[model samples]
Target: MSEKILNLYLVIDNGIIEEFRACSYEVAGSDEEKISFLKKNAANDFLSSFKFDPPVSNSGKKMKYKQFSRLEKQGKQFLLFEEIFQKFQVPDSPLICLTPVVDGEILSSN
Candidate 1:
């Protein structure tokens, strides 16, 4: 089956898209569950930049590591940040990477 997605209409801010999106997965659906999933994934991605060590012999020292409890807490907080953005819609800032999509996938950024 094809993957689902969240259709978010966001107001651009600064130079960002000002929308909900997952790191690797596409945001699918307009419901709270989908939005929350996107936020959670984004937070995980944001927190993934702080890894410094490898967990096991096979596992490499990838940036996306959840090592500490504090990191988990930070991830949760990052997910909640969407509320702030939703409350204050961004002003008329130019969208840099806005691209058209024929199917569920994005066409291109250029």
Candidate 2:
């Protein structure tokens, strides 16, 4: 049987991409476990500068980490993340995209 797989993508300005892969077999069975796996296995450089938060409008509001996992699972776009990338001057303004890949398919980037 083919196990579920997750691919984490960090897209930067200048069209540079960094990818990290994790298979269900290697990670725990729970959603939280999967997130932990990605966190632990993600690149140090990515993690060092990574920021998890909603957009500025939603600032001061707390978004649950589980929501991020859900977005990944559903292959939904994260507008706030895009804004964050823009705020940090990730190169191409709003072109810095981050998305999750399931199996061999890439989820959409909002």
Candidate 3:
């Protein structure tokens, strides 16, 4: 039997952010499609309410590059919530509020 792996990711840009729940099943063979569906729907849902591109990335590069960046497309690297908060130094500011994100899930079978 083949092993299964799951990954959850988030993206933020231009003051807009999105969270996604992703899963992969060895029998399903639909991880890419699932991630794409979630991202597309999430993007469409937020488009009317916010100005930002959907979170999409290819997490399988040796050098770790953004997969969706093209001449006609805009893409960015996905980071964890703490990474974003640390990079932006939101913790030092008293006025900034940081919320805990425990929505990540990974189910693997080997």
Where is the poorest 10-residue window by lDDT in model 3? 93-102
User: What do the candidate models score in CA lDDT, each in turn?
Assistant: 0.31, 0.39, 0.31
Model 1 has a clash total of: 5
TM-score of 1: 0.21
Between candidates 2 and 3, the TM-score winner: 2
Q: Each candidate's TM vs. the true structure? A: 0.21, 0.29, 0.20
- Which of 1 and 3 is the better model by TM-score? 1
Q: How many residue pairs clash in each candidate?
A: 5, 0, 0
- Model 1 CA deviation exceeding 4 Å by range: 1-22, 26-30, 47-110
CA displacement after TM-score superposition, residue 88 of candidate 1 (Å): 28
Give the Å shift of residue 96 in candidate 1: 16
52, model 3: CA deviation in Å? 14
On residues 47-92, what C-alpha lDDT tens digit does candidate 1 reach at each position?
2322112122245332222232244466442332244333333222
Task: Please report, as a residue range, the 10-residue window in candidate 1 with the lowest summed lDDT.
Answer: 93-102
- Best candidate, lDDT: 2
- lDDT rank, highest first? 2, 1, 3
Q: RMSDs, each prediction? A: 15.8, 14.7, 15.7
Quote the positional error of residue 107 for candidate 3 in Å.
30
lDDT of model 1, residue 85: 30
Per-residue error for 47 in candidate 2, Å, reads: 7.3
Model 2 misplaced regions, further than 4 Å? 1-43, 46-60, 87-110
